[model samples]
Target: MPSATYASRRSELETYFDRTAVEAWARLTSDAPVSRIRATVRAGREAMRAELLSWLPQDLSGRRILDAGCGTGAFSLEAARRGAEVVAVDVSPTLIGLARARAADPGLPGRLDFRVGDMLDAALGRFDHVVAMDSLIHYRSGDIVRALAQLAARTDRSLLFTVAPRTPLLTLMHAVGRLFPRGDRAPAIEPVAEGSLRRRIAREAALAPLAVARSRRIARGFYLSQALELARR
Candidate 1:
């Protein structure tokens, strides 16, 4: 059973993202609405996705990739375009529908598959690489660790995912932001003792960390986002 925190986070994500996938992707800065932002935010998000893809290599031809929690199919479709077979999974049927719409191209049909499944309950098949991108942001620590182990088991090469690091500065920012949050935008973060969590995940999942880099898009004082790459044992 999913914890209350995990279930609440899933509900919030499904409610917010399902209604505005495109708008969310075009985030100008922090949590500002799309109408109040510039085109650069969209480009920035694309760049971040590119960075996420960078963990692998220049060429992904003939590779099998799992884009777990893929939102609107951005990274998943990109992988397909680069000659990889991708399985794109997400929890929101609305978001999955949007992804399916994007995969309508004649050339993309054979390259990828899109499905709706929660991270905790999904039965993912084997793959050369697994990436969760920023989708695990609000997940509970225990669930995240469980997902990591399962991802590690199915992946032949490596697994990549993002986490919201807890720092003193970020802790302060979140506290203040909550008092005066913008409209219905999500909180900057909830505390994730990143160091201890990393250690715990490594111990429980039997995976070794390859790299942990701060994401340029969300590493400001508000959200100290880090992309973690774990290699299979």
Candidate 2:
């Protein structure tokens, strides 16, 4: 079971996303539902997703994938569309509900098992790949160490997720961005020192990085993203 503090923080994050990011998250960035204020952020996500998906096998004909912390199911939908079986999960019921509805629509051709649960604690089966998008922002550095270990355990092929890179400039930017504030939001950005994060995971988790790329560059948002691609021990 997750601790009370974990549960509370998780709830706060879910509420924040459900209220703010979900609408834009559910839509393709080119679509009008993404606000001008949100478009740049959404664009960064879109770019990140496209690049990461390209890392998958050329033929994902019957691969199994886990989409941990799948918000609004954008990546889940895309993976399914590309012919992978996806188990998409989120801590937020609201986001899972949206994803379930989207997956249920007759036009989509893919198998999605959408569930609402804590990724760290879920008893989900193994998969060929595990892709967790921008979900690690919810965790502090210590918490993220645990989360990455779990993700590393479940994937036979590869695991991928994004983290805020802790550069002096980006750290300053995150602090500055928080001041403007979303009315219902609690502070969520947890930037990790790229060097330290890689070293720690290598030493502790034993999940070696196949590739680590900066997906969302400084131009996109105050929060920059680095996508870590890890392989089994």
Candidate 3:
């Protein structure tokens, strides 16, 4: 079960993505031109996604993958194209709708089963690999470890996720973001120290079967996030 804090944060995220910043998010994930700041974010996200994908096999023909917190479904689409059965899920109905709309092409290879719900839902079943992208960036370190533990329970091979890396620049930008009017502000990202996160993961009993495999930080202009991989031992 998710802790109360996790549930609350999930609600905040659903509202932010479904109602508050749906248009802005859609624009950011698309080819449509965006402001310079968003362009950097898009680029950074692309780089991170590519890095995560590179960790998986290029030919995923019998694999079952989970695209947890899948936003506009770019990563899910790619995984599906590589012949993985992908269950791309998100808490935002609007974002899921956009993903479904974008993936309407009948000729796309493999299958993309997009759902609107918590990515930690056990009903979603097991996966050979799970990619969380930037989904867990808003939660605290403990909550992140807990969430990963939950996902790790059903993940057979590996789990790929990203966190807002604690850094001078990111800390400054995060503080500045708080100054924005509450209504216009996105939910604050919770920057995490990589060392602390790794320690917590190590202490998590549910995560004991997984070992930290690979990690890389991607920082593009206003965007900064670290991708971490945990594979079954």
Candidate 4:
């Protein structure tokens, strides 16, 4: 079960993405022109997506994968092309609609499932691998770990996710972001120290069956996030 804090954060995220930043997000995910800041973010996200895909097997035929918080479904589409059964889910109906629209490419394999709901829902079923890119940055450390624990329970082989790594640059960015107009700003990200996060994950009883496999940090201009992979032992 999701804690009160987790549920609250999820609600806030849904509101922000579904109502506040729909067009902005859609533009960011497309090739259309964007400001320099968002361009850096787009580039950083692309790099991070590639990094995570590189960690997965090249031939994913017959594997089940979950694209948790899949925004616009770029990663999910690629994973499906690689022959994985990809279930791409997010909390925002608007974003999921956009993802479905983009997924109309008939060339893609017939295995991509797009839905709007909590990615932690058991109804989504188990997976061979799960990829959550830039999805947990808004939650507190404890909530983030609990979310991972729930995902770990259902994930069979690996779980890959990203977080807002606590760093001086990210802290400065957060402060600057607050200066933007309230209507234009994204939810404040929760920056966490990587060491502390690792320690917390190690101590969490529900996540005991999984071990940290690898991690990498992606930093570009205004974008800074860390990807961690947990593999079942």
Model 4 poorest ten-residue lDDT run: 102-111
Residues 1-233, candidate 2, lDDT per residue (tens digit)? Answer: 44565667787787776666665556643356755657777777877888678878755768999998888788888888887888998877878888787777555455789988877654888889888888886567666766777666677788888888777886786688777756645546777887787667757634554444334333466325778777653
Model 4 TM-score, all chains together: 0.95
What is the lDDT ranking, best to worst? Answer: 3, 4, 2, 1
Give the clashing pairs for model 3.
none
CA shift at 157, candidate 4, in angstroms?
0.5
Q: Show where candidate 2 strays beyond 4 Å.
A: 1-8, 19-30, 105-109, 177-184, 205-223
Q: What are the Cα lDDT values of the candidates?
A: 0.69, 0.73, 0.94, 0.93
Ranking of models by TM-score = 3, 4, 2, 1
lDDT of model 2 at residue 123?
Answer: 83
Report how far residue 184 has shifted in candidate 1, in Å: 4.1
User: What would the TM-scores of all predictions be?
Assistant: 0.76, 0.83, 0.97, 0.95
Give per-residue CA lDDT, model 3, range 2-108, as digits (tens).
Answer: 99999998999999999989899999999999999999999999999899999999998899999999999999999988988999999999999999999886776
Cα error, residue 47 of model 2, in Å, equals 0.3
* Candidate 4 local lDDT, 29-117, one digit each (tens): 99999999999999999999999999999889999999999989999988988889999999999999999998887786548899999
